[model samples]
Target: MAINNDVLSIILGGGQGTRLYPLTESRSKPAVPIAGKYRLVDIPISNCINSDIKRMYVLTQFNSASLNRHIKNTYHFSFFSSAFVDVLAAEQTMQSKSWFQGTADAVRQSMHHFLRHDFEYALILSGDQLYQMDYKLMLKEHIKHGAEISIATIPVNAKEATSFGILKADKENIITSFIEKPDAKLLPDWTSEVSEEMKNEGRNYLASMGIYIFNRQLLIDLMSNPDTNDFGKEIIPNAIHDHKTLSYQFEGYWTDIGNIDSFFEANLGLTDSIPKFNLYDREQRIYTRARMLPTSKVSGTTLDKAVIAEGCIIHAAKIETSVIGIRSRIGKETTVINTYMMGCDKYESLDEINKNKTSILMGIGERCFIKNCIIDKNCRIGDDVRINGGKHLEDKETDQYVIKEGIVVIKKNAVIPKGYVI
Candidate 1:
């Protein structure tokens, strides 16, 4: 088997997603549920596997148990010994402090693993995103250009440009200026310095996709520097002035699912009449943990544009534009609309006490109504409850729970008693 030399993949899965609130309060942002079934980590891992990059590592911090389990089960490319996929955690191994302070810090902590590889280049990416591309082609361009660092970039409309890092490049596709999330007024003049020659030569201005490929030695030396602690805030921007930094144009279906609004929007995108993401591609299959279970059976139900996973029993529930997870049972006369429910596995030992404990896991508990709410994994809801998320609107005063864009998040393991309405 001929191996592709000079490239390695590192997925940044650290960072406490405080903005995401209760969803991320327990697990890292990358482990947070998406579309009821998939986690944020699944996006990048699927991309890497489809792109034919065998050896990859997920750098993690914060709450990592769920993230680790998802990686282990979903990414089983290692069933064949020739392939290697791993989840790397922050460790205190004879080299400085343990915790990951920032993105660069996380990579620096895992320097030993990269150091062992014979590959000369490294591809660094974030796990909390949805995109599909042939990274093998990207790597080919990186090596062909002799770039010390090559970044994948996309152009955004000027109005929404402030949300992302803006890039300024010169004529030869050489990146000169890189800024992570600039102000709105700074947008107009953000890339004003670009010469006409650069613009005419198809290399005017671009925004980074937060994807990077770097020479191994250059990355190691840069990461080891005391001052360079963050990739976005520090390292990459500084490298432009000193190193041969280049930009690779990325025209694909890419989305940053970092916050609640974006997360919900991305899931909605998947279920569009003509989806931007093509899941049926046999050539580039997006792999997930396929539990050997029976197909989802809708018991004379009316499902409208809803994604139902394996082992689900929808008993006459009018599911519309929603995403339901595995092993979940929907009771009679239920109307689930614009909602996401991550279900739990069925228990073999079902005692009376266990029945009370695992009510939500088993079924919707008769007449429990949920509208416009995101119910997380393993939650229990009792009978005759009318919970509408319209009550708690987005507020500026308190940080308790803000319902921005009308998406309400119910935390894991929470129980709503019978007839309780929100």
Candidate 2:
């Protein structure tokens, strides 16, 4: 991978992430734990580091306390290198009194800092996407084609196109038309050319991945319009005709884990025989905080294809196809299947656990049955509790739980009463 020090990278971490509600209730979307180890913000920053782009700015607004801590603890540069990854929280100033309204607006507000450096292009990325790409190639193509704006696009299927910004690029890959979250009826006219193999396999639609390469000046000029706040809805569609906008297609393992079902599947998908996304890649390693903890102690646990992170303790529990996160504690007789337990932040010492002998101790209590569910960090599942996800519930939020994308999402730090069945 070619290094580009002249380009600045920006990771958009400011979204409220309402679609990922309970997970976003306390921390920002990017701060949400993923795959039993890393946070969502690590994805984009890791990609930038592997691509050799050093300078980075993460824009955040909602519940940034934890996000800021994670970034501070994880990314640090030696004095020998100029690489820096800093978080730019939203604040009111003399120039602007309001917070970031959309993605484009967030970048515009933070442009002052990005422009202070002598960088040429700005590589804008999403915080919730899961993938790895050599942005050096994308920037090289942007400069090679003399494009004012180059968008990173991925070929998505029709079912997935409705949630994304679909586009149409002409013969030379210059984008001609774009639609933001087009309805299923409108997808017919927005189709692009596809290969015969893809035609036979059914992956055909070309969707904008919300990743863009912008010539610093063009981006600044485009942001002059106060109405162009959103990149997909207001920015790209208006710039395609006026600017030399090109499409850089990316064929990689990219998935938007912005919703409950997507998040659930993405975490559990890591346990597959052959995971769609590889986290163990040596070259493009996903970086996170270096936690010094003892090895996970597992004794006679009936485990099958589960990913148990460090600092976890599992007694004779039965876990199958689950991703138990760092510092997890599973009691005996608990059967967890197809679940993503984003384990506790810290372990309860034995004395503390003994003190709480009256009620169920922290972590999964004994004899609990959990399936197709997402148990957020610091959750206390009591004994005889059954979270078996049988019915397909959607967008139903309550004090006890929420069911979105047909998956039961127990809110973070929630406590389930003993003998409760759902």
Candidate 2 residue-pair clash tally: 0
What residue runs in model 2 are displaced by over 4 Å at the alpha carbon? 1-3, 195-197, 354-358, 392-396
lDDT of 1 by residue, 25-93 (tens): 779888887755667777777787777777788888788897788777776654645456678888887
Which pairs of residues clash in candidate 2, taking residues 3 or more apart in a chain or in different chains?
none
What's model 2's TM-score? 0.95
RMSD of each: 3.9, 1.9
Error of 1 at 353 (Å): 6.0
**Error of model 2, residue 45, in angstroms:** 0.5
- The TM-score values for the models, in the order shown, are 0.89, 0.95
Q: What are the lDDT scores of the predictions, listed in order?
A: 0.74, 0.87
Instruction: Please give the TM-score that candidate 1 achieves against the real structure.
Output: 0.89
Question: Worst 10-residue stretch by lDDT in candidate 1?
Answer: 395-404
